[model samples]
Target: MASNHHRLSGAPVAAAVDSAAVRITGLTRSFGNRQVLDDINLTIARGEFTALLGRSGSGKSTLLRAVAGLDHGTVGSGEILVPERVSLVFQDSRLLPWLKILDNVVLGLPGKDARGRGRAALDEVSLAKRESAWPHELSGGEQQRAALARSLVSEPELLLADEPFGSLDALTRIRMHRLLRRLYETHRPAVLLVTHDVDEAVILADRVLVLDDGDFVQDLRIDLPAERDPGDPGFQHYRTTLLGALGVLPAHRTKEQS
Candidate 1:
């Protein structure tokens, strides 16, 4: 494995070909006197969809950033191993306002067929026709779609998303959820989605993890059918379990009441 003692490195870890897509052992991150992540250990298998739920400042984003190699300062002793090809999507569509949608998607992409791949990616997200539109011209949800297109343009093996739909309206968020599920099915990338919404995590992930006070408090496998319905009894059970983990629901609350 590619191990770093005091800092997290994105370098590809040398492991068995059949090993997990991501592996972190004893990972810790601190900001001055505050420890954001405390000896975190996690493993994400190939093509697995895992959702992380946590309250604000609970170290969810901090852990995701460490795996993405976006955090560079003073990580405590640990090792993080991830696929060399990883893509990240943030809460806001960080597309440059000056670039057209197509340009934004294909930016820094290598190969002579980069534009073709970019167009295909846009089409996958239903944004092909809007390729020529400026970033400012699209709605918030549309801009996020463009951002998704950009993330998938490279066919990454791992996708890290940090509350990518948090800012959207309720209706738009639902639509985006459907789109994301479809894309995940189509691409089968190992996905780590960080969200504060318990229902969203239950609906989208194969397994849901709840982080509290810089450590994972719960890891629940979601065994519902792929065509998940919010009204399904099994779905409700999982949602309630996660809500209790997040302290959104009372520990003694019944599943039906959640």
Candidate 2:
């Protein structure tokens, strides 16, 4: 596969007015004869939080990797426009066991105040006191928190997360959800979170997208209040709509009803 991805910049004045944090046009990715993405076009506004949901092999991670410029084998005719500063968080924390928590956060970070910024990032994730601890010393959730700090230490303009909380238990996932929301608000970075959990998407995203068969099938804006509760009627409404788009009936809804 040959890469067709390029950096986007130098837009005209009118286009600059509507500039996006991440813009992908006519993007497609294929492995062998199977296409993962099919001429998909997407634009995420500055500081907008967008969640992507899809079943396995639906190309969620492929799209994210394309934007992050990590898809070396990507072959398609498309243009991806993203800020120079981009950070990615995966399902695993990916921390170096040999490095201390603070060092892990600041790894590869440049500048004289890198250490100070690393400390501040750790503080934001509530891991300030664990700066000297090793990755193995922290719990599963704490390690993920450190990973988040590492992503934010550079103050990226766009943050891409691929199931960053998938490994945690139910309670830890909820806590991480709240923490991610707070960080998003404080940092105001354009975020694209790839998740399988519909509830998580509805809780954290300003807009939700459903991808199926290598194309985006639904684009729904989340209009719920910031303080969302799963039991709220509005929350349930969005959740149901998204679930329906993914071709899954709600647990309470039966095939006979449909």
Deviation of model 2 at 53, angstroms: 0.3
Q: Each candidate: what lDDT?
A: 0.87, 0.86
Candidate 1 whole-model C-alpha lDDT, 0 to 1: 0.87
Candidate 1 residue-wise lDDT, 97-212, digit = tens: 99999999999999999999999999999988999999999999999999999998888889999999999999999999999999999999899999999889988999988888
TM-score of 2: 0.90
- The lowest-lDDT stretch of 10 consecutive residues in candidate 2 is 8-17
* Stretches of candidate 1 exceeding 4 Å from the true structure: 1-6, 9-17, 253-258
Report the error of model 1 at residue 124, Å.
Answer: 0.9
Please give, for residues 78-163, the per-residue lDDT of candidate 2 as tens digits. Answer: 77877767899999999999999999999999999999999999999999999999999999999999999999988888899999
